[model samples]
Target chain A: MKHDYYPPGIKGIDGDYTAALAGNPNTGKSTVFNALTGLNQHTGNWPGKTVTQARGYYRHRGKTAVIVDLPGTYSLSANSLEEEVARDFICFAQPEVTVVMADATCLERNLNLVLQILEITPKVVVCLNLMDEAERKGLKLDVDQLADELGVPVVPTAAHIGRGIAELKDKIHSVAVSEILPRPKPVTYSQQLEEAIRQLETSLQRVYTNGISRRWIALRLLEGDHSVIEAIREYSLAEGKGAE
Target chain B: MGVDAALNLDELIEHGRELRNKLGPETEIQDEIVTSIYRRAEAIASKVAAQAGGRGRDWNKTIDDLLTSRLVGFPLMLLLLGGILWLTISGANYPSNALAALFFMLEDKLTFLFLRWQTPEWLHGLVVLGTFRCLAWVVSVMLPPMAIFFPLFTLLEDLGYLPRVAFNLDNIFKRCGAHGKQALTMAMGFGCNAAGVMAARIIDSPRERMIAILTNNFIPCNGRFPLLISMAVLFLGAGGLKYGSAIASLTVAGMVLLGIGVTFLVSYVLSSTMLKGISSSFTLELPPYRRPQVLQVLVRSVLDRTLFVLWRAVKVAAPAGALVWVLANTNIGGMSIIEHLAGYLDPAGRLIGLDGFILLAFILGLPANEIVIPTLLMSYLGAGALLELESLSAMRELLLARGWTWLTALNVMVFSVLHFPCGTTLLTIKHETGGWKWTIIAVLLTTGTAFLACLLITQVVQTLGLLF
Candidate 1:
């Protein structure tokens, strides 16, 4: 795949990185995006709050980085447009890193989106946003410990006040470049579902070498996700008759 | 798993359950694999996530629970809607009259200046009387209400109450076999029916989207509100000024509710016959409330919505004003053209519990709703040569002089609320449906519904000796 930041002819030029910014509804995903892009962004809420997507770009340490703002969805299920858009952008667009912006004031509910995204891509970062609001409610978080447990970097940010954004950018660049390793927390469904997923993932990984998480795709297949199956079929056909 | 994929999903799940049973559930390798994954994830989550203080009630969630409760939801929604309308109606009157007066005074000065310049008679009529009068009507009548309504509606939108409205009305739409998201589309209809029809594209199911498009006209568009309020004020609230505006607001809100009820009924009948399908499952997540950006909301909505509506009204109304001016001024047999037609329509109007003037108003109102009262005023006052009225109250007095009773006001209000949406909406329906058949269906449905409703209201009142 070609990267936009660096010309294709450049020698030893580090490839430009792409990151996805996702969050629960009203978790200040937009506030963070606006802060990164300096408010030179488009205006319009999602229709029926069903789906809204925005993209912003910035440079970090002389490497071009593009951040796609996925719609605020609670999970990556294909139940709503927001979820479908968010899920497709991560799996198909193949962003180098996916940042799940968690509401610090309501972390438990926000974690659902984070866990769901982590199940797809190993390159994940948890941004605990709205720290001010959390503090106002007398809550506290251990960012490093959270990072350690999830095998990913966690940053506390108050995007409205422009706090912790520099750290967020630096962490993203580092993670995307593989300078830091990510240890993702794996989730489980029912026993019967897990047995099916294990067999499905082994088959998928052996069949398509460069595709997204085989386990997540298997779970989607079980859930009757036609879009995912169509995606896999297309990928297989593109790889040629010999590859499968 | 690959073998199971070849089998039907139902049979596969059944086999999986049998395999689990034979492997003795807890001791089974499948159970251990799934449990270990969950256990590892939960352990990590537990480590970094500490109990933040003692567990206490979340006030935000509590308030949301009450606000979105099924039992209290509908009533609370109506109360808020009625309150906003009451505020707009009561607050907008003085400004609307003042604006009308100011515009008319400017028109008169322009007329004097044109005469001083010795402009040609037809040129003067077309420019000053026709073009300027239409712009003035669009500004004076449409501006104040839109200026007031859009901000209130945007405020509700920003406060995140609209999603809850969709949630609350899900059952009613489910019963109709239409998408629950139709509630959101109906809210958009209150702003503009064409926009509402456009918004219905969000419903994934074509059947439900069509149902939404077909029924969108039942909700009174912003164009019709001015007419509804005017009639309600003249008839229902005639007893006192403040009370009149309040009652007028309630009356318009009641009319809106009737439109919603009719939308559901029509959707139910259509789903059962023309478009049959089970309603798709939908889940609405309520976004957390935020403090509205007052300045941005005001500026954006005023610039975006008010201007958009006014621009359309002006474009359509100018040609209409010229046509109406010609109709009123061209004399035949000592009666101008409009009088001849109004006289012709009077008997049919009377049988339908309306007068010729009211019928003529609806006929002329087809181009744009902003001019219905102005056209009726021109007819009754013999002001065929002149273009604009000075005030709403003067117009009210003219109708009063022409034997407008409370019964007349009630019939007019009902008809205005139920009549076909404006020309733009019809064209939009045609565009969205992509067929003339559905467009014709929409036109027939709304106009037929309006005629039937007014017919019943008039008949019941007359037969009961309650109206004379």
Candidate 2:
């Protein structure tokens, strides 16, 4: 598919697709980014190495895809700078596909970020990185089962060794082109909080007509995230004027 | 466009605030969200992943268990440290002498060329003996050990063992109300203090970062390695000890441990007094050990680190050497400037178990610690600039001629370990702290500690000598 896709709100982008790489710290997120984009961002063996976002592009199947490597963060709670940056990009940048990378050796801890990303975007492919390390640790992951659980494509990869990268790129291309639709399972909260979120989401939907997720916006609002509230107000004002 | 929409948005924000207030504290909300996410992740992972036969996991656990165990960890650390020092000292000697011979031969050729051109005597002394000799001394002395030590240290870093060092020392730092990452920075200081100050950026807390920056100087940088190694070899390696290399290595390792001790003591004092704050908690992830990339380690350590530090030292040493030459040759009130200055400082230096020339060398070596021994040699030999002895025993004899004893050698090593950081480190501290205030505090704190420590040891030794 030769579909032209820019990041949702950013103008003047010529790429056919935009993909974001997200993961926890030291999960070889940059390795996957470099592998896909063919750019060498220095990878270190410690946490908090990538404090800022790095962007590059790669061509696959006659399509140019721009990939942005978001800062490695544990969650989307907006506590630290990396978290704020990661959350903002996922919420506002609106890339066509987001590949949430996770370490296969420590899947449980890494899946935390994967679940949070799924709550934000349905166009996500969980890249199970460090498969070599996982196998060495005697941990075997059923990729099909994981994909079924998350309702998204799961690609096993050893990014440093350049294994499974072709399949990962193909998955990204398909997901970006809407060839594979992902219906992610939303994180369930308490009943009272769920009621509050539903109420807020209805109010948000009334004001917002863009493709942004009202439920996610409502959860952020209930979490007292001022940045999300400000973003919605700006988006509503900008888009609502033309609609009205 | 409507006033009603803006009012509704304000109401929405107010509603959010209300909901948050109703849901207890923000931390509790965060904790609950994290708990739910973690719970889901655990469930999904358990469902999708299975554990089987033992492999790298078992060996990694067994190794980490021994490496980080309480009884074995400290001794292993010391042994590794001592072994690295032994390797560096023994490996560097032949190469250092060879380089010195080669450079000094070049110096002779330059002198012959100067004479053939009929250059003035004073000008020849200033150019060839002053700047050239100083640069030569620094390169021959510093390049070998750094070339040896940095790659070895980088190998450890690449093996992912440095974080385990931090892990082993974390509880001690926590007890001192300092960030555990300070141990990592201090480990970096073993290579260079300026880099150590920069490494303090890894620490998240401003209070702890400052504490780390301030106390990092207590550890000797690579610039001081040559001097420490030389002193260790001369003093401890004397009397033809059977394990001369081992004895020297132990001495160097003991100095390093002493430096670490002073780092902790100063960190404790700073945290409890000036930079007081609650110790922030962080997760130190011990990464899985990967086989080190030998080619990458060699390139990074040799080019990025070893050469970079050698270049900086040469830059500072050249100008400082010329200045020392001028001071040693210039006479005022019937004595060379250096001699006058040393005589003036001798009493105070003696109070701290150091002599005037040693104190003078330290003062002149402020630009770079690598030049300290060279400066002392120049002043003591009554030469216009730095000179080298043919062997370590000959160098010991020269010190003995100046009334040097084992106590003097011990005190000099201690003083070198505890003294103020060199010029680059001071500037780095200023830049990192974004002000001169903390840099000056760092200088005063380290220099004061060095003096106090030397004074205490000197007096105690003297009193014990009288009793004996």
Candidate 3:
């Protein structure tokens, strides 16, 4: 009751605002966290190196924000602990600005998680890391066009070498304070699935009083993801108990 | 849509559960959701990203092909490991001797100061000889090799070569009926067995995870490396400079190879019998190798690994040193406590090609494998008076004075590689496996394998010697 599923006992993610970092593995997510927090969280070129979440704090534009680095997960399917941890923090904790870090060299694979997170929340900032690597490889992403396409802020960064960091913080600061509101145009499913989600969202919204997006919850319910439903159920019970 | 304030938590769960069924009885909603998400991602990517020459990944594929190729892979892995071990051994020699000389010189100064203060013999002996000597040796012997080895190892890890190792070993793991991810955990075990056991969570199958946990100790961790290196240098490398260093590295490499071989053997045996399972295939994506952060890696690893490991060894060895002094100095009916204990265990230890002091050290080093040689040296300090302790030759002299043969050194190396996991690792196993039963089985499996291996080796060697 006292907490919203931030995966309890995670220290230092309580500030004026909170941002959660999510991405596919080896996408420079932790490097971005270090570049912001100035903390040397281990960054190795190994998947699952970060088996658990790490939390850090940063101050930008006179606003001190707590940044939680969720474990690198491929999807919100919750097939593994990494996925479950990333999903719960995003769905329940609902940080103000969610930075979906993506690899600039292979934007397509990284965008899978970015799109998934967009469905769950509106304020998404796509931190396109490894821009230098991308450039050396003769590849580049049109950052503004990416922003326009995804309906969010896309900040190009060679985060390891500290380029584009200032702009990233500026975007994060504005988004957290709602100056740059991200009305994310998330994925639309088939007609039958959309109809099912609409029917579920109508009934589910009444039971869910939190800031959680109703359509996202409906999609998850239809998909039979037990962890998401179980966590939301418990959160609602606590809310109901606290209300009474 | 907004009139459900009266509904309670129980109703919410019941509604959600029943609602899952209302989605037309599994009409591929999950598949559709996933497909649409990926499709959306692809759509955005097409619009925003400019295509590269598309040959960026070709270099990575070329390297991965050579590294994992059946013809060149295993040999290259062996050479790299052997070269690293060679470098660690060669690089460690001067620094170890210098530190040993420095610490022993300080020990003499501390001894003079203790005598000037008119401290009693037991007090001076405990402080200067037992505790200080162990701390000095642990630092001098343990720090340099780790300082060199770990940075290089971290360089490889950072350069994205470790996963390629796992990739190369996948087929062997598959043949063993264990998950290929076991290779990843086994690679982790080279750093620390406790950490390696924890890394087993990546393996999805419970049976394969158990196999990884039980067999992890076979890959000698950081704690065992110093012992293996010192033994190899002194005993196997007695032939002088050129051949000597090469042989030393080869012996250490050989021991490492044997440890790995035993890992696969034990994994295979377990998977076929007690813990049966099909080896599930996995997607092993090799990350593109990046240029390693050389200066940063050196500073980070030396501080994080070298000094940290040295600090731990000092903390543990100091008290263990005092305990060893007490055991070796205290008299019971004219025989020291260590002598009595060693005497009781002497026959068993002898049959396994080790002395009782060595066996006692292994037992005492249960908390950590790093402390075994420190405790043994401390025991020697009590037993052998006025003997110097510095350098490989001096260490060899000390061992030679205490009646150690080449066979003793070889068998000690053998036993060190195969013994039970350290206490911290056992505790980690308990946490990972969630019970005492598997932990107990782990102990028996490792120690049982060790005792049998050493016994067979010693018996065979000695019989061969007599006939020759």
Give the alpha carbon lDDT tens digit for every residue of A100-210 in model 1.
999876676667677777888989878889888777666667788878667688999999999999999988998999988797867766676678777666555444424
The reply for model 1, stretches above 4 Å from the true place, is A1-15, A39-53, A80-82, A238-244, B1-57, B239-242, B331-351, B355-367, B379-388
The TM-scores of all predictions, comma-separated, are 0.85, 0.88, 0.85
Q: Residue-wise lDDT of candidate 1 within B1-468, one digit each (tens)?
A: 333333333343344444445445433443454344546546655565565563422666776888889878888999999998998888778888899999999999999999999999887876777667767766787778778988888888988889989988999999889999999999999888989999997788889999999889899888888778778876788656667787889998999999999899989999999999999977577766666888889998888888887787777777777777777677899988888899998997887688887889788888777778656665564443332479876666767778888878887877777778777788999998998899999888888888888889888888899964
lDDT of 3 by residue, B285-404 (tens): 677788898999999998887888778778888898888888989999998898888888788899898988889899989988999998887776676586767565788888888888
DockQ for model 2 equals 0.47
Q: Give the best candidate by TM-score.
A: 2
The C-alpha interface RMSD of every prediction is 7.3, 2.6, 3.9
| True lDDT of residue B101, candidate 1 | 97
CAPRI tier for the interface of model 2:
acceptable
Question: How many clashes (backbone N, Cα, C below 3 Å) per candidate?
Answer: 1, 0, 0
Ranking of candidates on DockQ, top first? 2, 3, 1
Candidate DockQ values, in order, are 0.26, 0.47, 0.45
lDDT computed for candidate 3:
0.84
Model 2, span B234-261: residue lDDT tens: 8877668898878888899989999999
TM-score of chain A of each: 0.84, 0.85, 0.89
Model 2, residue pairs in steric clash: none
Q: What share of the true interface contacts does each candidate keep?
A: 0.18, 0.62, 0.60
Worst 10 residues of 1 chain B by lDDT: B1-10
- Pairs that clash in candidate 1: A151-A183
